[model samples]
Target: MLRERVAETIYVFTSSRYLEVAAGLIMTPQGCVVVDTLPFPSESRQMYEFARRNCPAGIRWVVNTHFHADHIYGNYLFEGIPIIAHEETRAMLERVGEQALEEAKQETPELREVRLRLPDITYRGRAAIRLADYNIELIHAPGHSSDCTMVYIEEEKILFAGDAVLPVPYIVGGDLNQMLATLQKVQSLNLESIVQGHGGVLLRGEIPETLEAAINYLKKVRSFVHNAVSKGASERELLAWDVEKAGLSRVPLGGMAQELHRANLLYLYRSFQKERLRRAG
Candidate 1:
């Protein structure tokens, strides 16, 4: 795991082994707060140890930005603390996460040690965790997933944008419209930077251009897929839509960006096909 201290009390941990998934730690006078966890316990445990050694007050809470296993699997390490997330996230974990874990363990034995830790504290729209000097705001920003949440530190103006914001907008099990709306909402925030769920942190100077590129990529993919589907293009043809052509670089996240971009195009193509079928019916 690669750890970088973004601020005086804020630390971002990126998993070097898996898709560059990012996690965060916020130190306060009261205690420490873990934003998310890594995919493997080995990497995640490093984060726990770092927090224990650095924050003498102890870890008060574990905040999951979403229900994705990559982000919440290591919650087992912080078992006692309050794990918070959007209500939908808890529901999704119960309804889908359980089965997914069992299947994952079958393929990857390391996941056998993981236990699903549902968020004990769940909110509808927004919630806040007030520390001595920081107010951690949890805002519902469903996009990458229906249960997506964004963690914003009011004092620092740093947003831990789960999958809601990434190098390329991925909507495989998510809604394109919702993702677009959420990106617009993020654009309106007075953000100093953004800790993306899957890549390096976006600094203040890179914020505007990165966000604009993501927004454009999402819009471009949707329009391209919709047009191709309208013209009755085959799935293979639609899948050929290059990531670069849609205004996104395939180099981010160690080339995983291209794969995600392909998935987005395929997802949009299928959704457009479904709409067409419904209209015909």
Candidate 2:
């Protein structure tokens, strides 16, 4: 139900589950291509129904931005469709698909009867999917997640940036440097709009500035965490460091953003320690 027509033939749907997880649908002459599927089965079904009513042609393909649970839980509902994603995405799903489903089952009764499904088509590096009127270029951009890929609709001049772009950029176990690098690369592309997985949309003029802002945030976090690590800061102290005190603006994360941020700090700290140990050895 959380869906909207963002453009002439493009529709976006968000799941109410959490983080307002978004998926996109592009209606083409041949058929419809779904960018990502919602989290809950019911919500995802509704999304499909809406598409079916509006789009007479059946689905041509389903693309997963990443293998994250929220973005991929509805793969079952999309049976027989050629599900496509980055090759690494398929690996991640194969590695953790069962475990993620089990955990989700424990979290909500809605997921109790759900089954995990994976990508049928996988590509490494990049791929060009030729649609009837548009060309979708799947760029494997690893940052927010190792399997993350940005889908650029050529003719429409819109980019469906998966988890690679967020309202408040969040880095889990991904490489901080790689995140910045990918953002910079995406900035150079000529695009009219960017549809993020979370936090709605970014228009043409606002795109560069917002990408820079996100890059700056990641840089500030990395610098602060690095400095803290250099000063004999314990893991607890590193985790407790305030982002605001580090001169970064507060972002809406339901307070759990701090926990994730701290976890990022921990990841950086561990990386630093490993490097130092290697040098010492």
Candidate 3:
């Protein structure tokens, strides 16, 4: 069921296992704009029904913050709708979306079939759409992914930041510098509320402080990797070094420490390789 957080204006739809992540819906007189469609079709339908009852106008726009399966798999649920997303997002979806859906089907036969539908409308830098009651601004924040974008409600001052601003470092496949730059760009926005693709909503006032912490964490991870590389540490050794430096040995395998820190290490490794190549050149 969708929980009414700020009335019909904003709603949260969550999954059982994915408690850290919640899809958001914005209601307007014209229709409803959904941000980050959940992974499963059932969850998407639940969100759709909630929005229909709350708005009843229709779903005019569906925004896939990124090309992640969990975010865009629900696009099939809103087929024929004018889905809007970043240009990179559309490209990535076209490239890998089908494979993701097929893989999911093989893994979960009981789940409803969801097709991979690329966004019909895509914007490069930024795009602003005027809905029935509010203006939705799509800002390109390429951190977590090349196509990651943040949805900003201008009047409400609420930003639906995809996986860009999470509580922990979830830098699975991204450039560390680019992600840091994206976070800096997001910090510059005049936002009153920050909603992450994963994790609960955060007030705007808390953003600056939280952003600082995130940046510092990334820097520390980078430093650790750089120093280890300088000492000719292997990947396995680097992993152990990270565990000691970050004090992440206690968290569960699938928990924040493991997932987030693993991604951070991968990013650090890539960054180190790039720096080494530049120095060699």
Q: Which prediction has more favorable TM-score, 1 or 2?
A: 1
- Model 2 poorest ten-residue lDDT run: 246-255
lDDT by residue (159-262, candidate 3, tens digit) is 88888887775677777778889888887888778887776777856778878877887778878888877877777876664443664343432456556686
What local lDDT does model 3 show for residue 205? Answer: 68
User: Which parts of model 1 are misplaced by more than 4 Å?
Assistant: none
The segments of candidate 3 whose C-alpha lies over 4 angstroms from its true place after superposition are 1-4, 241-254, 274-281
Per-residue alpha-carbon lDDT of candidate 2 for residues 1-281, written as tens digits (9 for 90 to 100): 47777679998887766777889999988888999888888988898888778777789889998999889888888878899999888999899899979987998989876788889999999998887868889998888888898999888888999988875566776888889988987888898899888767789988988888888878888888778767878888887776555444556434555555667777888887777678889
Report the Cα lDDT for residue 234, model 1.
92
Off by over 4 Å in 2: 245-248, 253-256
> Candidates ranked by TM-score, best first?
1, 2, 3
Q: lDDT for each of the candidates? A: 0.91, 0.83, 0.77
- By TM-score, who's the top model here? 1
Worst 10 residues of 1 by lDDT: 262-271
